[model samples]
Target: MWEVFLYINPLCSFCLKVEQSIIDFTRKNNIDTQYHFVTTSNMETINDYMILKGMKPCDLEGRIGVTQDVYDASLLYKAAACQGNKKARNLLMNLQQEVNTNQRPYNDETIKLAVEKSGLDYKAIMTEKSGDAVKEAVKKDQELACKMHVEKAPTVIVFDDEDPTKPGVMINQFGSETSEEIINENLIAMLEKTMPHQISEPKSKYYTNDSIINIERYRR
Candidate 1:
């Protein structure tokens, strides 16, 4: 099994695509994996998102709640995560697609639509969105990013759960066609190297001169 921490901006198009690819790859392979979708609260990351969208900081002045949208989305994501990781991920993906693909604003309407589409309890999320616990969760995510020295969004940290002594592998290269392939290869290699091997004694039909013994090895 692997523990993956993916730090991303909920509104970043590139981050959305990369997240989808990673999820598809893991599900396709039926890998035992845990994903932590950490929405970044850094200004640099927000600037990068704006740059990717071909917008300057000045443009945000006219769009109300634009700057605060990032933090708001982060809170919403954390609230959604209280229900389930999948729901939280779906909410982010929906928000990204609306903002990036549909060219929609991250306002109340967009957030509501995304939450509805993500199958979240709107009442529950709203009740918990600004709660102390959710705020603490978001703060913890920020602390984790600082501890890991993550200064940008769309960063992935892969930890080999079987071997905790080893450091987590950091992946920050993305937004290229080859990024998916690169991540896929790295994940496969890590699984091969770190996944535990099992050996069991097999029932033998024939006995040897000394004993009936057969050893079977399986890699998972």
Candidate 2:
């Protein structure tokens, strides 16, 4: 099994796209993957970062001026993760879809909708106790992001299952002007390099040399 640490923010459109691409890639390749979601910022300062990244502040729907609400969403995600990985992922996906499509605010109402969408026990996971634990988890993830020098959203770190001491390879799709296929191909190439023997026989359709070359060309 491979561990892929994905640093993401709820407001980042690029992160949303990249995460889905990774999920699709993993599913198609039949790769056993453990995904860790990490947040890089709260709502307080994310707007400035968005502008810096050449994105509109309004792209996140109800996220523009809401201070710490996005962080609250991250906490909600962590609380869901305590129940199970699938629940957590579903909540995150639901929240992202709401924000990107419906322009829903990252408030308690949105959290409720996400919980319902994820099929999680709302009363059980939305307590003060779970909130405290989620706060700590979010703090830990932020610290880990700092240690890894992750300054952008949608940063993926692929770790080798056998070699614990070796440094992991990081891949980012934040500022890339290329297509999602190229970004996914580069990410798959990095994963292949990390775990050479673990890849299955039938390759994913997106994993191709031409895509890799196209990504390199875009970089140049």
lDDT (0 to 1) per candidate: 0.71, 0.67
Count clashes in each candidate, considering only residues at least 3 apart in sequence or on different chains.
Answer: 0, 0
- For residues 1-220, write the lDDT of model 1, one tens digit per residue: 7677788987788888778877776787677788888887676787777777677855757233455787888899989988998888899899999988899977888888999999998889988998999998888888877766778778766666666665566656553533565555544443443452431223222211111011111010
Q: Residue 56 in model 1: shift from native, Å?
A: 2.2
For 1-220, candidate 2 gives per-residue lDDT tens digits of: 6677788885555677778887888888777887877767844347644564466778766344443656777777777877898878887888888876677766778778878988988887788325566788778877877666666566777765566655566675333533676666666666666666755334334432211111111110
TM-score of each model, paired residue for residue:
0.77, 0.74
Clashing pairs in 1: none
Model 2: clashing residue pairs?
Answer: none
Of the candidates shown, which would achieve the greatest TM-score relative to the real structure?
1
Point to the candidate with the largest lDDT. 1
Candidate 2, residue 132: how far the Cα is off, in Å: 2.6
